[model samples]
Target: MKKSSMKNRLRPLLLTAVSLTVAVAVSACGPADEGAVSAKPTAAGVEPSTGRPTTPQTSPSSSASSRTTASRSPTSARTTSTSTPTPKQAIVKNTAAPRTRAAWPRVTFARLTFEIPPGWTLTTYGSDACVQPVHRAGLPTMFDCAGIAIKSGSIAGNELRSYEARQPGGWYAATDVQPCPVRPTLADGSFNGITSGTSSPPVESGLRPVGSRKAAYDRWTAACTSGYRFSPQAWHLPVSRVLFLDYTGHAETARVLESVRFPG
Candidate 1:
């Protein structure tokens, strides 16, 4: 009977131990499939694959495309760098000044011919052919050097007798004159008694334009021989080729100006 009681006790304990082990095994294995499913979808970014989830080769195609893009960037940059060019800029320069003529024409008296430049005015002498024309009217007079009158026409001269000393035009006498003993250096520069004196020493004469081509001035003086005459006879001719003809208290400056003599 004791042996039968002991066997009954051992059987109850074994049943209790078997129940605890079964509870432990169920707890350990619970929801393992759910965990695997949730983790697979998170890694894929879209949905879990029906095939192998552990494969590492899914993103290689995108990586290869990125490498190709990076490789082409250097070549594109070089092409852009080689295309542009710099243009040469032109330099600005200064303007030059106007030039002046150094020398002009000088000819002997016998060969001189009448040639007038443009803009020269024509004037009449007294009773003769001597004509007067004024150019560069503002120039200083040869004798006075002071600002002379800028007359394109007539004026009076220094008086010698009772006759009117007024000249017809601003320059040159056109009158037929009697030869007085005075020299070509008019007035002989001798003021004492202009009455009856010998001729003056020959010197250059004539009133020329300041920058005229004729080159030199003709100078002379005039006086009466008898003192009874109304007009003075002695006269001065500064230059013959180019001349300043003075008559009736007027003086005319005649000069030849031309670039080239047209063979007439």
Candidate 2:
């Protein structure tokens, strides 16, 4: 009976030992299985049996496309530089002035041709002709010819006297030379005594430069019935039958009269 009890105790210890050895064997095998799993190829186009990584082959078109995409990406992200411009200025210049024009054309009456300046108009009365300034609206009508006056019509007393004073050539000696029907003689014996004396006669009375030759001229005062006073200063040439008379004593009239001449 003691021998049987000893065998039972040894059997229990043997069973415990066998179980511990099995647990140690399983833990040791777990690391080796994990290493095998890691060694297997996982990348595309790789052989799992060989366990070696494969080099993927590329097409020419795919390589070109990848290069183009990389180039275009940098263009979209990059920035370009800009610059500013300046403006210009303006300029100016200079020039000259204008000129003055001359007077009107020459005029002729009977054998007398002369320049009447720019400001006079000519009119005809029957066979007689005369010129008057534009400013003179109403004035005595002066005639150019004494015979033309008698043939055409009788001249006014004021106009007749003016005509006589202007005609130093003694061209006209009509019986109707008297200005007034009954007039006062301006030159009495006393004035004649002063004039006849060799004391230098009036400078304007004898020959002086006029038109194209020596001309006779004199100053005289007339009494008008209208109560207005006037001194008809005049220059006359007997040889050329030309006369310039200014009864109103206007400076412009004198200028025009001085400019009168026979045109070539």
Name the runs in model 2 displaced over 4 angstroms. 1-101, 126-128, 134-208, 225-227
- lDDT digits (tens) for residues 1-264 of candidate 2: 999999998998999999999999988886557778666555446554455554554567887898899998766666322233345565554455556656666775645555555666665655455466566434443233211111122322232333443333222223333232112223442211111111112224545565556656655544333233444455655445445545435545544454555545
What is the alpha-carbon lDDT of model 1 when measured against the actual structure?
0.37
Best by TM-score: 2
TM-score of each: 0.22, 0.36
Residues 1-264 of candidate 1: C-alpha lDDT, one tens digit per residue = 999999998998999999999999999988768767655534245544576654443466876797788999998898888766667798877667768754433322223333333443333333212222345354322222111112211222222211111222212222333343233134555332234212332233343343324333323343454342212222222233222333223222223323213223
Per-residue lDDT of 151 in model 2: 16
* lDDT values, one for every candidate: 0.37, 0.46
